[model samples]
Target chain A: MKKVRTKQVIPLFMAGFAVVFGWVGVFKLGFWNPDQGPAPGFFPSIMAVVMFLTSILAFIQSFKEDGTVKYEKQELLVIASGAGIILSTFIIGLVGSCFLYIILWLKVFEKASWKDTLIILAVVAFIVIGVFGLWLGIQFPLGLMEYIL
Target chain B: MQNLQLLLHGFQTALTFQNVGAALIGAVLGLIVGAMPGIGSLAGVALLLPLTYKFNPTTAIIMLGALYYSNMYGGSFSAILLNIPGDSPAIMTALDGYPMASKKKRPGQALLTADLSSFIGGSIGICILTFTGPALANLGLKFGPSEMTALLLIAMTSISWLVGENPTKGVVITMFGIILASIGMDTLSGVPRYDFGNMYLLGGIPFTPYIIGAVGFSQVIKLIMERDQGKGGAATDMKLTIRGSMITKHDFRRLLPPALRSGFLGTFIGVLPGAGATTGSFMGYAVQKKMKSEEELGTGAIEGIASCEAANNAAAAGAFAPLLALGIPGSGTGAVLLGGLMMWGLNPGPLLFTNEPDFTWGLIASLFLSNILTLAIAVCVIPFLLKILSVPVKYMIPCITVVCVVGSYSSSYSMYGVLIMFLSGIAGYLLDKNDYPTAPMLLSFVLAPLLESNMRKAFIISGGSLDIFFTRPITCVLMVVFFGVVATPVVKSMMKNKTAGKASK
Candidate 1:
């Protein structure tokens, strides 16, 4: 119950932060010139205002709310790990990143055997290479492999 | 007689070797994609759309149309066997389907029932499209920006029921989507808004990448997180045995009423913007629940499958209604279809009916053939497809992941698209974690630009008076209907509560 309240309230606070940043991005930064009828920052400025008002309403509502749900740490681990994997993929490229994420998550995090992880990794990598790269002619970023090859 | 001539011409168009080959390929691929969890018909069609850039407009549309209808049938396979609905519309089916699978009383009976109902509903829907699409297109010719704006408003309001416990949150999300939609350069003024000096922002976010990120990548993350919880899919052990006689006499008798009812329901709902298969299937399921005598429902009833299957296929056909008449999509899949239509250099509206009668009628006729073909293919292959269930999830997830990535990259040959894919994926994950429905958010984003542009254009044209929205008779009538539709659920809930109070008294 307490967790749900916190979850609801935090987004509103974050949205408030969004408003401040968005406002600064537009008005404080001097991005809009006097001659500009509707500057590139104009719409975002409006959005920031709306976000700020909505966030305030959200904050008010959070206090009035009753607790109905619980948040779990496992869920957060999933979210963070998934995000981490995706970011790492961008840096190391598809194959290497996917391999690292799969091997570590399965073997270490999931407590699966090394042999099982290796088999899973090999199958995924080969098929992805075969279907996406070869058959479909899609250009997946090779990452560091690009320089090596 | 005129109908006969049109039908003949449609047959001529649909029966060509190229069309047949395209239909066959489309049905096979669509089935495979639809059987995978969370990869809806929309994604499947969108993934295949670029290939059509090389084909003739009619040929390309026919292929996509086939894929669309095939997904309707194929989606049911996963829903019944796995209790994991492959598409949003199949959710209702999973309720009864999972129980039926647990009982193992009938291996393929439920699936066959669903497929047959889809066939029946799809045929009816296609017939409606053939006869009514042209007429509606003719009517749309008279509409201007004001009327279009009113129509879109009606559509958006219908989503009020979908807003969950917090209508405000839904509205906020929707407003956010609309605002995001307005980020790109404006068509009328040639002025950019929120592009942030990036040239990529000029074209606005491409529909395909946003969709894949918001839907596809989000789903993958969700599955991985819930992997051990078996939130992935129900593990059904029984193999489906496909046979013509699997649909018993009782099944046929039980099926027709709900199939026809849901078919009409789906077609009508499909005509409305934002009211696609998800809404249509729910409505059909709700109607079936009401009609059932409490003894027949939630216990592997064939009628349950019939109603949902009927509505889903009908909705698939129904979504084409507004697209053919107004060039506006009623759902996410419809948006992709609209893109395909535009790619063909074919603008759908009243002008289309007169200028390209053959194209319109032929497309309608091809839909009819596609449904029949899907039924034939699914029935013959159901047993084999069900065998795929025995394959370990460990192997399947990676393959599906590859498909998802490929689908995203194939949308455009740009690395930036992949970047957008990951960003949207992250956003989707956050939204999912926060207990927000991604569909409404995605929907609002898609409809935002249309709503804003139309409202702006109408205001400019009307010299800033809101009267333009009311001046048009069709628009006024539509607005009333929209409010009524949005209010019905709330009203029904209130009425139920009142009845309970009276009973207590």
Candidate 2:
């Protein structure tokens, strides 16, 4: 079997999405209604068709391209940090996740001095707490700590 | 002229303590964010948007407007000093700006030319927008459902132009945006759409968070990937003061002509659908290449810096015309601003001029104020800005990430928005990695609902007949133009292929 190129991945993914969307649009959501001029499904159904055709075209076109950009090793840390931030929010909440992610990323990965890390941490804290919290008054999501408390 | 009086009144409103204060803050923040590499106007606006939720619609918009306007000035700083453009529009500025700064040994003068050129270009754009905005709104009022549908179709087609080379990828992304937009509910029938039965899908994806994730957070992922990639070393050794950055009379004379020409040209480009400052600056630089310059462009010429710098600022000002007049966004930042307008509880579109003259005009007046404010601040802070460029990418990565997290969460005060931000950030990185343009997706996402609404309304009016799009005069003209835009590429490609085929044979 021939190995698939990284470039073809997204187009193929979109093509598959279009197929499911087209099926749902036609069957579940009617394309046209008797009373309404165009049904809810009308635009989506048409768009799905266009999307599928274009995605397939893009997929085919990808074969002509030479080199593909590979993922960097450091990028895994960033992705992990993003996931960790989101996951941390479940336990520590929004503000805590900010503190945790910044600290770990700076200390563990960046290997920055504690003094530099704390200074950046303080500025970020001011923004999240002093500005976003006290000033703007946005109600942040409650973590498990809040629920437990 | 009535515009003069309205503008004067606008200044009166803008001169108020709060509005002036807002403009000042916006100018400062705009420059800071604009100077930062990787965080362009789109992300700047998106990251700052959540902070404005508590502001009055007028004040919030004034700040964001200043931020957007001044950002054009901020972009040239790094482009000239370092080789990296702070934003996409500044790519052209870098060509001559860095050369003039380094090779010519006039970093101060290069920075000055950019600031002055920005001032002149932005002023030209504002003046044109002043006369044209109300006039366009008046014209837009004459448009009914069919005409609006046609106009929106034109807007939708312009996004295809943004995707250079691969028409198929453009089409795929554009359709994908429209589909994503259709997920929440049908506006006409009040029926639920492709929500997949998720409770959060009932409200659809939140606009601000989606934008922040797509443009800003994605940069986080991108920066992480490229952390080791060298940033042409920061100019840390030099210290610059405003007085030190003065240009010679000869330099100013050389700068003025191209700046003036590009100002008008950029303004015209700005008003076009899906054409923003990037195109404006690119075009301005390209035009200067043909004309006589004091020195050849890309070789430390003042004219080269002036042309692109002036044009981008002019284009930034000009973009407000369509957004304020017809409620159409020409580019991603324009779309973000449109989203801001809606968030501030003001209706955008033709009626916006008639109904909310104060809000509309105040924003325009504030641009003039911001241009001056940004110029002064931009000059005084050149020394400080270099220091910012020196900030390690390692620190910036975590800082931007936190902002993305906080900004997304603040939009709706929910983890749902944050989830969308993360998911979209990953998707955005993937799309960007594959060389797919995200600007079209963002543009269509904002315009698709308006397009679908107007299109459906036209269908309803026409009793399901397609003739409505073709029958009305204004609509017919617009549809003709839309078809022309859509068909031109296809025709060109066919011609190219035919020529190739003949040669091959």
Candidate 3:
């Protein structure tokens, strides 16, 4: 079996995404109606078709290219951190999640001192809560704190 | 004379303490953001866009406009002192600016020349815009849906062609953007199209988060990916002093002519859709080089610095002309400004002059004042800017990410917006990694609804006939130009292939 290439992955993914999107637009969204001019799905269906065709062209173009998926350890860490952010956002509130994210990013990724991480986290939390919450009056969603508070 | 009176009234509004302060803060912020690598004026404006939510329309426009033009001045700093350009427009400046600073040992002089030339260019651009804006708006008032559709088509096609490496990719991305835009409740039909059974997406993926994620967060990711590559390091060793006689009499004499010429040239280029500061700077630099000897052209010639800097600044000012007068954005930044205008509930076309003369003229007047403020603030903040460059990228990354989250959330006061931003950032990163240009996607996304609505109106008026586009003189001309822009590259590539085939034979 031939190994998959990074160049091929994107186009293949794009093609798959386009097909699904097109299917949804056609079957679910209702692509056309005789009484009305163009329906809402008309534009999207056209886009889906165009995207599908382009993805195929892109795939064909990628076949001649010589490259492979090359993910380093650092890249994996970055991806993990990105996931950590989303998970934390759901687990904690916006401000709390941001606080946790800063601490972890600083301590783990940046390898900063505990003292510095704590200090920076305090400042970031103050600014985020102060400016956005107090000043702008934005009502951020509460997560775990919702029950406690 | 009446224009002059209106400008004075504009000055009265702009010179208020609050407005002046906003402009000052905007200029300072723009300068810092522009000097930072991986963040250009687009992201700078996008990052700060949420802050404008509380301000009045005039103040918001004033601050955003100040940020946009002052960014041009800031971009030249890194281009000169270091070989790295702070923004795309600054790329040409780096060609000669770095050479001048390093070889001539007059970094201050190089910076001063850039600043002065930028001022000259900006002043010229504002003067032209002030006079031509109303006149152009009058002409634009004559435009119907057919003409508007034609103009929008031209704007979309031009941006798609000029912005990216591959025009095909640009068009595809633009189409995707239009699809994304069509996801919300269709205003005419009163039907939600592609919300995917999700309540959060009902408003159609709030634009602020989408843009912030795409431009800002993706930039952070790109920076992280390149962190080990030793990019974004400080130029601490290079001393950028401002105390001495920066621009000597001799240097001024040599720089004046090219600066003035490029100022006009840049302004003209800026007025054209999709012809931005990058094009203006390169064209101005090329023209100056063609006029001079080889010795004077590339190797730290003051003329080289003057032409590029002046042209880019002028182009920055010139870009506002179309946006203000015709509601057609001339560049990516201008498109963002157009979005801001819509957000403020102010229509940006001809009626804007009559309906809100204060906002229109105040913005124009503020441009002139901002140039002067930029010069004063940029020179004073050189030391501070140099120090900022020394701050480690690691510390900045988390902070910027936090800002992106807060900024996106602040726009609509929703966590879903922040999530949208994160998702958009991932999508942006994936697309960007594949060599797709996001600016065209962004421009098209902003224009998509406007284009669709106008096209619909045009067809309805014409009783569902496409021939309406050809029947109108302005629309006919615009359609021809649109096709010409699209066809030129294809024809050129075909000719190149033919020549290559003959060579092979």
Task: Highest DockQ: give the candidate number.
Answer: 2
Model 1, span B173-220: residue lDDT tens: 655555566666766567765567798887677655666566656555
Model 1 CA deviation exceeding 4 Å by range: A1-5, A14-55, A64-77, A88-92, A111-127, A147-149, B5-22, B32-65, B68-118, B187-190, B196-226, B229-233, B237-365, B379-435, B485-505
| Number of the predicted model whose TM-score against the real structure is largest | 2
How much does candidate 1 score in TM-score? 0.71
Q: Rank the candidates by lDDT, best first.
A: 2, 3, 1
DockQ value of candidate 3: 0.39
lDDT score, residue B149, model 2? 77
Q: Per-candidate DockQ versus the true complex?
A: 0.25, 0.61, 0.39
Clashes of each: 0, 0, 0
Total backbone collisions, model 1: 0
Screening candidate 2 with a backbone cut-off below 3 angstroms (N, C-alpha, C), the clashing residue pairs are: none
Candidate 3 lDDT over B1-505, as tens digits, reads 8889999999999999989998998898888767654356887787677899899999998999999999999888867764445676776677677667656656677788888999998898899888887564345345677877776676566554324456556666776777777778876667776777887777887776777677667766766765653323443345545664267888898889888999998887677666578767765775675465334655788898899899999988888877888898877788888999999999988788889999999999999999999999877766554443344567767776776777677665677777787888877776776766675565567666767767766766776678999988988997898788668769999999999999999
Q: Tell me the tens digit of each residue's lDDT in model 1 across A1-149.
A: 13455547545754765566466548643333444333344444565566566666666665666654454665455456545655665678765666676776776666767787787777677656664456445566766667878
Query: Candidate 2, residue B173: CA error in Å?
Result: 2.4
RMSD of each: 6.6, 7.1, 7.6
